[model samples]
Target chain A: MKREKVVVEKIVETFGLTKRYGRQTVVDRLDLTVSQGEIFGFLGPNGAGKTTTLLMLLGLTEPTSGYAQVLGLDPRRWPLEVKSSVGYLAENMGVYGDLTAYQSLAFIGDLNHINGLSQAIYEALDLVGLSEVAHKKTGQFSRGMRQRLGLAEVLIKNPKLVFLDEPTLGLDPDGIATMLELIERLPAEKGLTVVLSSHLLHLVSRVAHRVAILDRGRLMAVGPLEELAAHAGVSADLEQVYRYFFKNHSQVLSEATR
Target chain B: MKAIIRKELADHFGSTRFMLLMSLVFMISFLGVFLAGQGIREVLAGGGGYLLRDRTFLLLFTAPGAFMPLTAIMALFGPLVGLILGFDAINRERNQGTLSKILAQPVYRDEVILGKYLAGLITIGVLLTALFLILTGLGMTGVGLVPTIGELARLAIFWLMSVVYLGFWLGLAILASIAFRSVATSALAAAVVWILLGFFVPVLGQTAAAALTPLEDPARPRAEELAAYDHVSRLFSLASPPALFGEAAVIMLDPTHRGSEQALRLSTMSRLDRLLLNRFQGVLSVAQSLILAIPDLLVLIAFSLATFLGSYLVFVKQEVRSA
Candidate 1:
């Protein structure tokens, strides 16, 4: 079974990746592996180092010690190679308000050094239902519109894998539903692997094929949501299983902070 | 890098702030030319036995009446141009949360800084070149005479020197942006340093000279009695970028300004003696004036390179955390 999985080419793999700032270790010795063409949820609460881990995996930030591979290339050794094929949508990411939506997409195309991308950009914008406002300045965009534009910005390059960090952050109920629908469709429609990081359990439960529960820089559990819930003897839901895993220490930490 | 430069250029050209700055540069240059043209008209109307009445166009650079010359105005405003170009280059992007998004693309992190700095330099070059061309055109129409080859060569050198001088402020502002996370804080910091270098240092240098080397007899101060004051003041003034740029630009654009240091030597020169010196030096080769200004150019280059190096060191080692 392990040999078959190796033959299929795991999209992400890490062996004890760690990051430290001064004396505080944000991401401890973490061993993680994510397979290809599946929506993998990296579930954690605030201050759980999800963003830092994603940054390291994307080669935006260097890890203090450990190994990491994204799409068969070590991100530390081949950052540009990994980044060229990986689309990252950061939490609360901003659009260039000065530019029209079309111009912003064109600018990203230029930055990526892609040639003859007008058709691809238009398709991506239409995919996100932003074609109507393609010529409008992004400064006037609502949060939902901007969020969709950010997704379009990522999708325009036709990345092999897409990492969405808190994709529904600061969105209204309607916007959240739209974003979740888009996230659900990303892997199925685009033949792309996804690493969706979020704090909301029910949202991750809705779309992610597999989930990893992280607390205070340490992995508490990993596997399919049903399997983790069954193993922990809890109801087959993300929130219950997550609570079962972090029940030992999160209470103490929350109380101490309070 | 090309993409970054193109975007930056678009941003600058489209920005109302840049339009206002360009308008200011245009208005000042035209006013300087108009005022200097009136003086040249006076010389033509038998005002005085002025030297180079036929070459009255040179006065537009050397002695614009009741105002600093066009080159001086540029030297004064050049830092503002540079500071505005880069005061928020890094911080604004970081604040907008676009820095990480852009860095996550295929481009290396260094490319962002390199592209932005090059954009500022290119903008400075274009803006100044346009102003210089306009000034040249105005001088031709106002004075009704085209500049000589030597004058054009001098103007070209002055243009290059102004770019280098402004580059110092540009680099410093970018460096400030990199160090500070807030755009407003970075802008205020850049403006503070700009004021210190552009205005305060020169003023402080004169005050220091007056206090340290007070002439015992204010009635008739000897050249030797004031030598200490001149030397001290020049030393302090050279520490400021504008002083270095202004001194070099004046030397190149106005060939008649022998050297600021030659004052002590020429203090004993009578009116006729000065006239004779001007007549002899009016025919001085371009190479001579260029050689005289080389030291100031070197100093300006050094300042620019140092600030660029500082920015590079801070930016390369800086970490992009989860903002």
Candidate 2:
């Protein structure tokens, strides 16, 4: 059963994935898998290499060593093909401030060589609840609006999978709720697999079907919340499970550095 | 790439920097025309309209600088226009957090840098075209001098030369933007290079020549010694882009300019004396002048291409995630 799952329908698979800068490894020998139409939360403390791993998967950065396949395509060998099929909303993603929201989406559409962009652009905007402000310049947008616009940009390509990095950073309470709701609904409504990386364990626990805990560039744990919680001999609380692993794994980091 | 180019062109045209710089250029162009017109008025008064009948209408560009001529002004200040337009092209995108987003899109890596550069080039082309048309129109209306077909073609050639000259600076600015992370740092770096090439380099060339080949009796050196001194000075200045472009423009615009005797390989004095014996032969033929400026033009083009390729390689090889 596990072999069938591994070979048949996995959307993301990385084997011994590693990234190093000079002598310091930022992502170390990570083996991970994400099935289609699942919310995979990537949990980490600061400097845990979450963003670097995402960059490697998206072909923005190359791994020092390892094999990664996204949606059955190798990012290193076929980046454009991978990019066309997978959407990525980078941490602190930027919009062209002088461009109207509609224009920005259309620009992304053009980059992807998407034909008949007007309807797709409008649909994407509608999905993000920014339809009313479609013609407004992005410079005048609030933080929430910009994030939504970014979501619209990601959605315009209609990819099978999306990677959203810290999508709720700097958002207000209401904005956070909106962004989280959007991410949660993407799998059910759009049939899109998602990899969401963030430090907010509570939020990830609420929205993600499975969670991976990372610390110091290593995959500390990866599984459903209850499974990981039970394995750690803790209650099915993501914070407890994360803390249990963090406390255990932080020593490995210090030893490696030493 | 087309989308990027369209967006960049819109941004540059709508920008306050382009507007401010273009207005400055516009004002300077008008002032140049006014100054040249006043000089022409005195000439026409002294020698009548028949005196300039045989001269090409493009002579306004190479007009002897009673005040600084238009080509001279462009040579001096054109780098500012191109530099300001391009210095912040990539770094601003990086700072605003847009560069990574663009890179993440499904396009080849060179598309972004190439599109931005093409946009800058197109913007410059438009500005120069407008300036050329305006200057030609003003010459016709204000001074009642209409260019012949050959003269118009020469003007077009000069316009193209101007673009190539300024493009070298634009490419340098883009390279600086890609190499540096901060907009301020890139702009300052580009400006400093511009200042060196535009002002300091030529001055340094003169100082270097004086230091190396000091003439004890500086007032009246022998002909061969003076020629040698000029040759040494020219050699030093050749490293400067403005000096190269300046020599090319002067030669291309004024057909009578055979080139500096000390720097040029061929002595044109005999040819000039032979041509002067014929009343209608004060200037070299158009083909001859083009041949004279070909080497200068080739050098300018080669430098522009080198800088452009340098920027291209830097941009393609850079790590976008670092931004």
Candidate 3:
């Protein structure tokens, strides 16, 4: 929390960002913004459009109708530019089992056209605490190690912003703590903006400066935890704030049906 | 794109399945060539130089041996290599959840597919070249005859065509990989396509051709009927890649094989005229052989490009799910 110079520049912005697969709207009209140097959390359960929205922002999937900007570049028009600057750790992301950790990072480094590749790979692996097994095949890695390798893959590119989707999905407690610590250090130590998406409320609250609660492709509430909790008339705990919004949303849905 | 191509090449070359498949192809080819060489040696020993014919060096590939010629074996099983290399190209990545990770980078969708297809093509080219070189070495030692420059040129052209022929299968397998979600489904689909096009379609072509143009006199069909049968059968067989490869390979490998229709027309010629025609049919120069085989070459290239383009379009437009 270095707040010496508080210049809130919007790192990501979207207006009416909607994504529909045929008749189903996976992501509805949504306006959102993330400032530079903050961990933005996208909190939603499975099939709630969290992953879909992340894909749209990364320009991996085109939005049905709407606009998205990543690092001041329109994602649809400048996908490569946006992607080059933004690292994305997709949900359930995996590594080549046959490839050693070093080889895997080397491939990513090559893709990003990183100069001094060997040095970069070493730094990335060391940062994720995976240097001990750099030569070991990734197929032998545990779930936590693989997840950490995925993070190393992101950091190897030295991206200005990173989108991490359920990065600790199947990790043990120790693994989760290590992953969180790595994430928590990104903003301050590396000047990276992180947009972390997960359904785990407490973990997100631990690292994310702001969280956006979504349900059924719609944004329910978004703000700092204290601000959101205050708005929802609940205590400043993410779990309580999340329940407050979700309960009201369900009631609103039932009323609309009636 | 270069990075992707390099990575895919490493994967294809290092995989155990690829090693097994390569060895299988090697053993089959070695057996075929060895048998052909023994048959050639016996003829040469019996002072049957006339029977051995021109382009004797090329006989190592086209001569019948161990149930089938080396060319026939290639036409049948070369596709398996391509199919195995590409059947799970995209889907396996999607299944392992690595596709999204790669796509999320600065790499374009087309680059991914194009790199994969190129890697597969390069692998096929290397495999075919190495196989041919080894067979040629065996032929030199066994037949005790050095290949003339003309024989060498024809061998080179045949090798290039084989690469393209197998490249078509690689493209089709990649298309299957992109179209199907599950790796198992794509693998099954590729195998099914290989069987349908390689074995079933050629047989079906013969059946359809016979049905379309039945000889009025089965015991001794008229020349016109024979010509009609040849024309109709060739037309049907051309629909299959293996048949295309086989037909084109004949003209490229055997200089004296003028054309299928030409051979059938000889049946209508007077006995003396047929004899003269057979004698004068002489070995075609490599340039002439290439000119004759251009149509098949173009078609094979088109088939390969079309399948690859199909995969590209499907992949670019398809939504990438993060699984």
Candidate 4:
């Protein structure tokens, strides 16, 4: 029964997805699957095509080759439908400074045609611990406060799946902890499936159920920490597991050249 | 789309940038019109033949003020409002990272551009309507004259033309915003275009016309040479949006304005012909003014639609990824 559920609950599936810009390939032949209710981490270095892949999945960008199914719909054919069902928290996403937190959420709600907007705004604000600052203009918000509001924006959409790109990029330690805790609780509390893309492995390790490490537009490894560690013949820690794959890649390159 | 339009309207009306610029335009235009009204009052008191002129009330716009006429002020500065409102419309959203967020919603991509364009048009319409109302009120009280229904109709058409003219500039600004990545670059581009079209074009046209239509006699030029000079200069001036607007507006506001052909004939008239010329060449009907102005009006409309369509095409085809 558990096996059947796992097989039936894939929320994001991409087959050999490839994106190229001019002569440079940004995301290369990536085959990935994200199951429902899981915190799937996309771990990579800068320029590893993590953001490109996310954009392609959201249909904001067209892939050069391959296919992706998001929420049982091909994003290319029905981008509006795919977008409506998904919440995306962009890196460095900004709210209108002139609008209060509640107003910005209301604007988003109206655009998405969401009903009971006030109720949704209040609930989302409370969940993200921004209820007290709901009336405050976003321009005056601290970085941590803004990051929490971004999460609230995602929550207000009430999406089945959410994509968070570098959600804790500029936050302090306290802010990071609060954000991670919020992310960790989302699946259980709201029945959401999250795909988090970030370069900070330690931060992602705390919340991600399974992770895919990518390098130079290629997927290096994908599995739970224990499974990745066993493959690398190292202890089950994300740092060591990550190093094992990248370090092996260099050795393989040297041997082939030799 | 409606939501975007509402948000944009609120942003435009509430922003200090827009308010400051709008108020500056209002104050200057008010000062110009007030000066014009004072002059008109003096003329009214003198009881000159101006009273015999049809649509004499419109002189408040056409009459020379302390410096420039109200029409000249609008011709020079009205484009600034449209340019300022739109120069940073798209790039600012990208820089702030809000564009991607908005696109991620269910909203169609076209809605973003269409909504913004409509919001800008609405704001321009409201502000221009308010300005005309205030100016008309001043004219009625300060000049102690009530406009006839025909004059009001002419004024209404002039107001619509001004909106369309400013909209052309707005569309150009939006095009610049989409073509350039930085807000400063787009702003500079729009300003440069405005300068080229508004200030430099007329001077350039004069120089070009003189070169193209050289006179045989500098002191006592022949009728044909003068006619050719006027034709060539007018042709060159038509290249400018402001010039086009000025031509159409002058005809619309002044009912006595026959087409350019009559103006040319009058300039070439002998002294006896001038004295024998009928004193009662009655003012043109409103229908006559519309017919005379149709060519300029059509070109102005085309200019507006082409520019807006250019921006729409560029915006819809643009990649949403922010650098």
Better of 1 and 2 by lDDT: 2
Off by over 4 Å in 3: A1-6, A250-258, B51-54, B266-280
As for candidate 2, its clashing pairs are none
Per-residue lDDT for B1-323 in model 4, tens only? 99999999999999898889879888988888888888878877887664644577898888876767777888889999989999998899998888998999988777887788889988899889999999899888888778889999998988998898888888889889888889999999999999999989888888877898888888988888888887887887777898888888888888888767678888789988866775746688888898888888898889888887888788777778787
Off by over 4 Å in 1: A1-6, A249-258, B47-50, B53-55, B208-228, B263-282
Candidate achieving the largest TM-score: 3
Quality class of the docking in candidate 3, CAPRI style: high
Model 1, B35-135: lDDT tens digits are 88777767767855555522355677767577767777777876888888898999888888888888888887778887898899998899999988988
lDDT tens digits by residue: candidate 4, A186-222? 9999999999999999999999989998898888888
Q: Model 1 reaches what TM-score against the true structure?
A: 0.91
Prediction RMSDs, each to the true structure? 4.2, 3.6, 3.4, 3.5
- DockQ of candidate 2 (2 decimals): 0.76
* Residues A172-205 of candidate 1: C-alpha lDDT, one tens digit per residue: 9999999989988988899889999999989989
For every model in order, the fraction of real contacts preserved is: 0.83, 0.83, 0.96, 0.85
Structural similarity to truth (TM-score) of each candidate: 0.91, 0.93, 0.95, 0.93
**Model 4 docking grade:** medium
Q: What is the Cα-based TM-score of model 4?
A: 0.93
